[model samples]
Structure formats: structure tokens, C-alpha cells
Target chain A: MLPDPQAGGQTGSLEHIALLRPLSAEQRAAVARQCRWRRFASDEQIIDHWADTQDVAFIVEGRVRVLSHSAGGREISFTDIDAGELVGEMSALDGRPRSASVVALGEGALLAFLPARPFRDLVSGHPELGLAVMLRLCDKLRGATDRIMDLSTLGANNRVHAELLRLARRGRRQGAAAIIAPIPVHSDIAARVSTTRETVARVMSDLTRDGLLQRRADALVVCDLQELERLVAEVRGAP
Target chain B: MLPDPQAGGQTGSLEHIALLRPLSAEQRAAVARQCRWRRFASDEQIIDHWADTQDVAFIVEGRVRVLSHSAGGREISFTDIDAGELVGEMSALDGRPRSASVVALGEGALLAFLPARPFRDLVSGHPELGLAVMLRLCDKLRGATDRIMDLSTLGANNRVHAELLRLARRGRRQGAAAIIAPIPVHSDIAARVSTTRETVARVMSDLTRDGLLQRRADALVVCDLQELERLVAEVRGAP
Candidate 1:
């Protein structure tokens, strides 16, 4: 049997990422040759926040988690990065220290890296790429702002509810229910919303009893996304 | 007094903002003709989130706040934008609806607008300008991430302490204290930290009794920035 074409076999070609669309075929080919690509196994550390990275990387295949550790030994995962998206560009672009470490979420995940100098030239030589990068960064900034809004505005249970709604979109549908495959453990939700695992469990328990939330084998099923959002908003003022 | 060169007077020339350094004099003059500038009074609404702005704006003088209203009518002020910075670019760059409204906090706030088409040309014409914009966006992204970390990792009082440390640097310093002139009101601090006014007031009272924070004639004085940092770190379980 032929091996799956992309099963972590190579770095994702530049053409696969929309951000590099402005580059001519020759430019993309040249960039491909200059870049370094590697496959990572599940749970492998990708980059350390303490040390600076000289090259920027893109996720070519599979998912990885961005996270940090607090002085108290508490770990918080920021967000999951998917294929076709750029990673580790923040430090190289702004000359700031890396803010988080990354680890692969699955085996056969691919990553591609380009040295800083060449990457700069690529953007400068192709101004379209610059606009693309700015658009991408703006989206990240907006997403971060939304999370901050949630953290500052929502209470513990409402935050859990909000997170569940976000997760629901990733799952399969079953008769009006959205099943988030491979359910996130309570601790994961707690870290995302800055609350306690026990509090999350309690909220989930109550929601389950009320039939607003459900659990399937290895997945969480959100039955009513709209209702959940309404409930969250109502909680913001219910006092 | 020479018409107060910047205050409610003239739109700033492009040369004054650091980001435009890459533009040639001719280019700056041409771009200047394509853009618009005006001043706003205190508490004046500048843009609506419901609409998309075709032109991006720059703050030439005074301060403004970026904020949004929750469905329940609770207003969350994301951050204050100071003079000599860009605003409303995110929506124009990404073609997304404006995410928040901006309002001037003081009279004589000068704002400049450059149409989308010329703005695009300006960046694409000069890749260095693209690099500059990316650097600026990267800085904003980092600041947002820091706020997210603080929200997710710190409790109410520790968040308060962290914020004070941030504001203290803006004021005059005595032996070991930095006096933040025109102290941010309790509600403002609450809005920034995602807590409530009562919570901030209670925390301030505790800190005052402990002699770690003080109020001096419409100003908030932070005593010992190092101690403030230490306290915040200790809350994270540092010895």
C-alpha cells in the first residue's frame, strides 16, 4: 500500500499556506529548498520559552499545544495550533522573548522553519506577504482580546459554559447535539478559564442534570449552544 | 501661544510618527493629501463597532479608550490608546467588523485617517513599512498576551497589585515610591482587571492598612515597585 501523502512525510510546501500565495512558483520552490522541516511525535517538546529561536516555523501537519508554567507549578495552555498556520513568529518579528513552550499533540506532525534573514527578505521582496502577515497577526490580537474579555467578564460556571460552546464547534453532530471528540478533562477547562477543576465539574454536573450538556463515549456533547450562550449572558447580570 | 501646534490644531505630519520613517518625503506628502485628520472633544465617540471603517486612524494627541458593551450592558474598557499610535487598523486590515468603539478621553484629541487603497499601496510599495507595521502589531499582540496571563493566573488582589506596578512607572518617584498622578478611579481599575469596584476598593483598603499602597490627592502612590513585584510573585508561590 502506498504511504499516505502527508502523513508527516515532509514539511508542508509553501503553496499549501495561503499566506504565501503572493510568491511566484519559483520563489516558493526556492523558499522550500531553504527551509528545514521535521516530524515530531506526540508529547514531544517543540520549543523552549527560555531560549530565543532564530528561525520561524509553520505547522505543516497535525496539531500542537502552546502552553506556559507559572512559578507555582501551575500549567496553562494558551491555544492549539493547527496545520497551515505560522507558529513562533512573534519573537522573531518583535525581538521579544518567546512567551510559551510548544508540544506536539500527535505523532506524524510536521513543522517547517525558515532562518530569520531570508524570511525578512521574502516579506520585503513580496509586499503582499507583509499584508498577509499583518492580517494574520491582527486576527491573533483579536482572538487574544476576546479571551481577555471572557476572563474579565464571565464568572466561573459561565466561563466553562462559554468554553464548552467553543469546543462544540469542533465535534461531530448527533441529533441536535455537538459531540466534541476526545473530551477535554476538567483540569484543561479550568486552566483555560482560570478557575478550579472542582468548580468546572460542579457546573457541568448541574448542566448535565438539566439536559443542557451530555457525555458520550470519549466525547462531550453540547445539546444546546444557543441556550448556553443565553445562559452565560443572563449570568452576567442575574445577581 | 502659536495656536498650540498639536492640540486641536493641525493633523500631524506623517514624518512625526516613527512608523512612517521608511517613506520618502515625496511619498509622505502624497499620502498625506490622501488622508484626513480632525480633533475630538472629551468623551466624544469616534467610531461605531457596528460599522466597518474604510480608513484607518492615528491618534495625534490626547488619550482614548477602546471598549465594548456586553449584552447585559456592562461596559468593558479593553485599554487606553495614547497619542502617536494607530487605531482602527485592525478592522480595515482584516476586513472584519469593528470589534470595539473608541472614544476620546480628553479635549483636543487629534486623529488622522488614511484611505484603505492608499494605505495598502503604502505598505506594499515599501516593504520596510510592512516590517514596521508587523513590529508594531507584534508589540500589541504581546501586550494583550500579558494581560491574558495576568487575568488567568492572578487573583483579584494580585491583579490589582500587578496593575499598580504597571501604572507606577508613569508617575514621579520619591525615595522608594512612584506616585501615579491622576490616580485611575476604582471603577477604571475594576474594568481593566475584570473585577468590580467594590473588590478593588476592598483590596486598596487592605493594601493601605498594610502601607503597601497609598492615595495622595487624586493620585495613587505605589510604594516600592520591587515589593509590589515580590508580592505578586509570592502569590504565585515563590518563596
Candidate 2:
């Protein structure tokens, strides 16, 4: 395995692989060599469902949406991945058809890696690397399970608020109110919350009117994080 | 690695790991030696959430429930695994915290395989085994993704019918009108479909009275599979 020389030695490191923590210097070097940086424009299909290709990606920068569509045109966005998060691990580990479609939400860079036959041989030959990959997949599964539980129990309003809070935390800047850029369209919010766009629109309008959030030039400014968290608590039926 | 003594060297052979297809003699022998059989009684917790253990299990007999709960006591049963299917592959592959809980529905037998280190080493050492496991995981993930989509888009009635059909296909015995034994309690169904137990009970009673199914002494029996499928289609809003 050779590291992409063009990456200028700034490609994503093993630390980005959060599930496989505490890597030694040698192990980090080995993994870093296998990673190649690739960039995608906004709205580009980073991973296509039903494609036969076997590339797995870890987001180095930007956001990617995990989406599914029904026969009747109903779309559901199960989750999103941002900087330092992993995607395509399921297809990479399982070698099956991609379960859903993934698209870049904006310009983004990813560390693309493929552990084909040679990689497998490497894993078998190097138990530590194989263990790291396995652990990483486990972390992905754990996160997915939590998302499933949340979707099952929480209502759409709560789901929206939780997602907003998550995005705010991810993109927060020091000493500045959290500003979520490229305010997601109502349809996108509908897909994520598993509700109709009309419903999402109504809720967003209500929130805007109530001074909880403000529509900005290119983003949605969450004026009060505490208020959002309180709404989440209320949705969870907390006192 | 040693083959099970009781199985007379047939253990882990192509015949044993039938869910994994097209295995070579060498590959079969390798898998056989690495396999271990175990048993659990009804309601036994086969896997606990967040436990530090690593073993992938294939159900040789009986049933198992896959479930998760929220901090506030909400429970959801994603699905149940019956004989011939594998469980714990996600945890086994990643070696992270267990995402959910698995409990035996009845007395069950399983062929448990060790920490992914050995099997993955085996796979990396042997491409055939690695490919076989990948394909199996792919199939499972596909099914899981489809179920998630159904839960997000379909109504409660459709969810129940689809689950019943799934159970019938997997649990049916020869010429017995498809007995779905040990019917899932109403609350379980409610959680699975994101509805209330009262709603689920009312729907079940309606279906029973409509002659599509029969509430048997020991199990729920689908009298006509076609009618049940039609009911599911109708509930899904099919024209």
C-alpha cells in the first residue's frame, strides 16, 4: 500500500477512525498508506445504490446524506455523516449491494479505501489491522442501532429538534452562536424526520414565529440552544 | 482449531454452513474446525447490550428476538431470527459495544464462531471464506434496510401483516397452514410498528374476524397466505 503523494501527507489519519482508537504509530502509518483522498461537489452521488464497485469512504470534510426511497416516491433520510465520520463501511465489510444512496450535501473530501483481496490478505496476515476494521464496523452498528431506537420512539417534531441540535454542536464556532449553513429544505427535513414536507414546513414556520430560530441569508441560526434542548425534553415526555 | 467431535467431521462443512454457498473442501474443513456449538433455554439473554464479548452465532434451531430500549423505558423489537440464520455478526465484526439485546424465544441451539480475529484472519488468509461472510452480511443488511423503510413509510396494519408473512415464511412447517407459534404480545407488535398496543390488538382482532387469519390455541395461524398478502398491500396503500 502506498499513500497518495498528492495528499501532501495531510490525508485523514487513523484517529479519524474513532471506533478503532489507541492505534500505535506503526499501525497508523500502515492505514494512512492505504488511504487516498477524493473530493466531491455539492449534491454529487458519493455512493450509488446497486453499484458493483467496492470502495468504502470516511468523510474527511463536509456532510453526506444517507437516504432511501420507497416505490411511491417517499424518501427517508436515516442519518448524515460529517467530518471524521465513516460511511460505506457496511458495504465494505459485507460486500453486499449498497442498502441506501449517499450524496454529498456540499463540497467535501473523503479518504477512500478499498480492502479488496490484497487487503483481506493483509488483514489475515496482520491480525491487528483486521481487528481495527472489525472494531470500526462495530462502532458503526452501535450508532445505527441508536438511530433506529430514536426513530422508533420519538415523534417528528422531536426528531427535527434533535437533528438541529446535533448539527449545531457539530458546526459550532467558539464565542459565536451556532449557525447551521445551507439550511436544509423542508423536503429534506421531511425525509429525515419521516414526516410529510407540509408538516415540516408548518413546524418550521411555527418555530421561526416563536423566535426559537431565525432564517439567515444562507443558513438557519439557532438563537437559543437551551430552548431547543428543552423542546427535545418535552417531546421525550420529560417534566 | 478442531472440528466438533460429535458431528463426525461434518461440522463446518459446506453442508453445515449452508447459508454460505459454494464452498471448497478446504474452506469447509477450515470453517468446521473453527465452529463451536452451544445451547440456551427460553428467555435466556444470548447477548447483552454493551458487553465486551465477540462471537457470531448461527441459529441451528429455535428462535431469538432482537430488541433495543430507550432511557425512558420504550422498547422496540426490530425482528426475530429463526433457525439457519446468523446473529451477532455486527458485534462480532466490529468488537464494539453490543448495540442491542438478543434473547432466546425458546430452547435453542447455535454454532458460535470466535472473535472475528480468527475468522477474519482465516478469511484474509483465505479469500473464499471472507467473500462468503461478506455476502451473508450483505443479505442481512439489505433485509434490515428494507424493514427500516417499511417502518418509516407503512402504516401499523401493514407492518403487522408484513411481519406475520415474514414469520409464516420462516416458521411454517410442512402442510400445517403456517403456524406462527408463540405469538408476539400486542405491546411488542405495537413497538415494532410504532403504534399503541390497543391499536395493534384492535387490528389483530379485525384481521382475525375478517377470516384472513385464525387465533389458534397455541399460535396464530394464517388461513390463506394470499389474502394476508392482499391485506398487507391494501394497508400499504396499494391501488
**TM-score of the second chain of model 2 compared to its true counterpart:** 0.71
The TM-score leader among the candidates is 1
Taking the tens digit of each residue's C-alpha lDDT, what string does model 1 give over A121-154? 8777888788888888888888888787777777
Query: What does the lDDT come to for candidate 2?
Result: 0.67
Kindly report the docking quality category of candidate 2: incorrect
lDDT of each residue in B20-59, candidate 2, tens digit only: 4455677556665677665567888888865776777766
Q: For residues A1-239, what per-residue lDDT tens digits would candidate 2 score against the true structure?
A: 32343556555555656533455667666666676666677888888775775656766667889887765778888677777667776666556667788888855545556455444554445545555555554454555555566677786777777777777776654344577887878888788767788877777788889987888889888888777877776655432
Encode model 1's per-residue lDDT on B83-115: one tens digit a residue: 777778777677787877888996647777887
DockQ of each: 0.55, 0.22
Largest lDDT belongs to which candidate?
1
- CA shift of A66, model 2, Å: 5.0
